[model samples]
Target: MAATKTRTIEQLVAEYAEPIADAVGLDVDDDDRTLSGFTRLLSDAADMLSPADCTREWLEDAAEALTALGYVDTDTARQAILARVDGLLYEAKSDLESC
Candidate 1:
C-alpha cells in the first residue's frame, strides 16, 4: 500500500477557500475587497489551527485575527464561532443517533 500524505491546514485551506467562501456567500471577484478580507481571515485562522500545542493561545490568536481583519466585529465573531460550534455539536449528536 502507498503511504498517505499529511497535508497542512494551509494547503487544505487554500484549496477549499474559494468554495467555502462561496458556500457562506463570500465568493466574490478577485478585485472585491470583501473577498480579499475573507481570504486573509481564512489564512489567519488556518495558521492558528496548524499547531498541536497551545490550543487556547491559538483560539485567542484566531479571535484577534477575526477582529483585526476589521470586517467582523468582536461580538459578531463570537456569535459566529458559537453558531458553528452549535452546528457541529448538533451534527455530532445526529451522527451518534444514527450509529
Candidate 2:
C-alpha cells in the first residue's frame, strides 16, 4: 500500500487564490501582497476551525489572531464572535470577502 500525499494548506490555497479571485471580478494580482494576505487569512481561519472546540474562549483565541494580523479590528471581531454564538455566521462562501 502506498501512503497518500496531502498538500499543505498554504499550497492548496495558493493554487486557487488567483483564478478564484478573478472569477469573482476581484482585480487581485498574484503579487506578494495578494499572496501574503491570502495566506495569513487562511491560516487564521484554519486555526479557528478545530474539531471538538466551540467554546467562547476558543472563539476569542481565534478572534485575537485575526486582530493581531490586522485582518479585523477588535470591534468587528467581537461582533463576529457574538454573531457566531447566535448561529449567524459566514463560512467559506466568498473569496473576495477573504481579501
Candidate 3:
C-alpha cells in the first residue's frame, strides 16, 4: 500500500501564498512574506476555532514565523492579513467538510 502524503500547514501556506497575495493585489516579494502573513492570519483565526481544530497550530506557527520575519505589526495590519487568511481558511474548511 502506498503511504498517503499529508501536507503540513507551512507547506500548504507556502504553496498558496503568492497566488493569494496576487489575487488580492498585495505585492509579496517572496514566499516568506506570504507565509508570515498567512501565519498571522491563522493565529487570529485559531482563537476563534476550537483547540481540536487542525488549523490551530498551523496558524500559530505561521504567525510566529511571520513575526520573526518582520512581516506583521500593528492591530490594523494584523487584522488585514487575518481577514485574507481567514477567507482562505473558510473556503478550505468548507471544501473539507463537504468531502
Candidate 4:
C-alpha cells in the first residue's frame, strides 16, 4: 500500500490561490501584501481542517477570513468556500484510500 501524503497549508494555498485570484479578476502579485494575507487565511483554514475535524469555530473563522479578504460576504460566497473545502477534503480522502 502506498503511504498517504497530507498536504501542507503552504502547498494547498499555492495550489489554489492563483486560480482563485484569476477567477475573481484580481491582479494578485505573488509578492503582494494581499497575497500574503490570503496565504495566512489559507494557512489558518488548512490548520482548522488538518485533522479532518470540522468544528463550528473553524468554519466561522474561515468565513470571516474570506469576508476580510473580499472573497464575498454573502451566503453564496460562504457556500462556495464550503464547496472548495469539500474538494480539498475529497483529495485528502483519496490519498488515504490509496494508501
Candidate 5:
C-alpha cells in the first residue's frame, strides 16, 4: 500500500494566501511587514476556517492584526485591506453555509 502525504498547516496556508491576495489586487512582498502580518493571520485563521468555523470576531481579528501592521495608512487603504481580508473570510463563510 502506498502512503499518502499529508500537508501541514503552513503548507496549506501557503497554497491559499498568495492566490487570495492576487484575487484582490494585493501586491504582497515577502519582506513587507503587512505581508508578514497577513501570513500570520492567515495561518491563525486556518484552523477556524478549515472546518468552516466562521465568525465576525475572526474577521475582526484579521482586520485588527492587519491594521496593527501599520500598513493601511489612509482610509482607502484600510478599506482595501479589510475588503481583502473579508474576501478571504467570505470564502470560508460561504463554504460553511453550503455544508
Candidate 6:
C-alpha cells in the first residue's frame, strides 16, 4: 500500500491561505501583512479545530478569530471565511482519518 501523507496545521494553513484571504476580503498584494494576519487567524483556528473538536462552537471561534485579526468583519465575510474554514477542517479530519 502507498504511504499516507499527514499534513501539519501550518501546512494546511499555507495551502488554504489564498482562499481564506479571499473569503475574508483581504487584499494580499506585495505586502505580507494581510497574509500574515490570515495565517495567524488560520493557525489559531487550526489549533482548536481538529477533526474530533469540530463543532458549531469551534466554527464560531473561527469567526471570532477572523474578527480579532482585524479583517473585514461583516456577515458576508464571516460566512465566506466560515465556508473556507469548513473545508479546511474537513481536510484536516480526512487527513487524520487516513493516518
Best by TM-score: 5
Runs of candidate 2 exceeding 4 Å displacement: 29-36, 39-99
Error of 4 at 98 (Å): 28
Q: How close is candidate 3 to the true structure, as a TM-score?
A: 0.34
TM-score of each: 0.27, 0.28, 0.34, 0.33, 0.35, 0.33
* Reference-based lDDT, residue 69, model 5: 38
Q: Using TM-score as the measure, name the better of candidate 2 and candidate 5.
A: 5
lDDT of 5 by residue, 4-70 (tens): 3443224423554565444333454554234555555454445344344554345445545555536
| Overall lDDT per candidate, in order of appearance | 0.41, 0.40, 0.50, 0.46, 0.49, 0.48
Which candidate, 2 or 6, would have the higher lDDT against the true structure? 6
Task: Give per-residue CA lDDT, model 4, range 30-75, as digits (tens).
Answer: 5533435654544444454435544323433443444443556676
In terms of lDDT, which candidate is stronger, 4 or 5?
Answer: 5
lDDT of 2 by residue, 1-99 (tens): 975344332443455444433533444444513435654443344354444534323333433443343454566564554344222112332322454
Give lDDT for model 4: 0.46
Summarize candidate 6's per-residue lDDT along 1-99 as a digit string, tens digits. Answer: 975344333454555555444444444443333435545555544454445654424434544554543565675654555555556555544443444
Query: By the TM-score metric, which is better: model 1 or model 4?
Result: 4
Model 1 segments more than 4 A misplaced = 1-73
Q: Could you tell me the lDDT of residue 11 within candidate 2? A: 48
TM-score of 1: 0.27
Task: Name the best candidate (by lDDT).
Answer: 3
In candidate 4, which residue pairs clash? none
After TM-score superposition, the amount by which residue 43's alpha carbon in candidate 6 deviates from its true location, in angstroms, is: 3.6
At residue 80, what lDDT does model 4 achieve? 58
Candidate 3 structure lDDT: 0.50
TM-score of predicted structure 6:
0.33
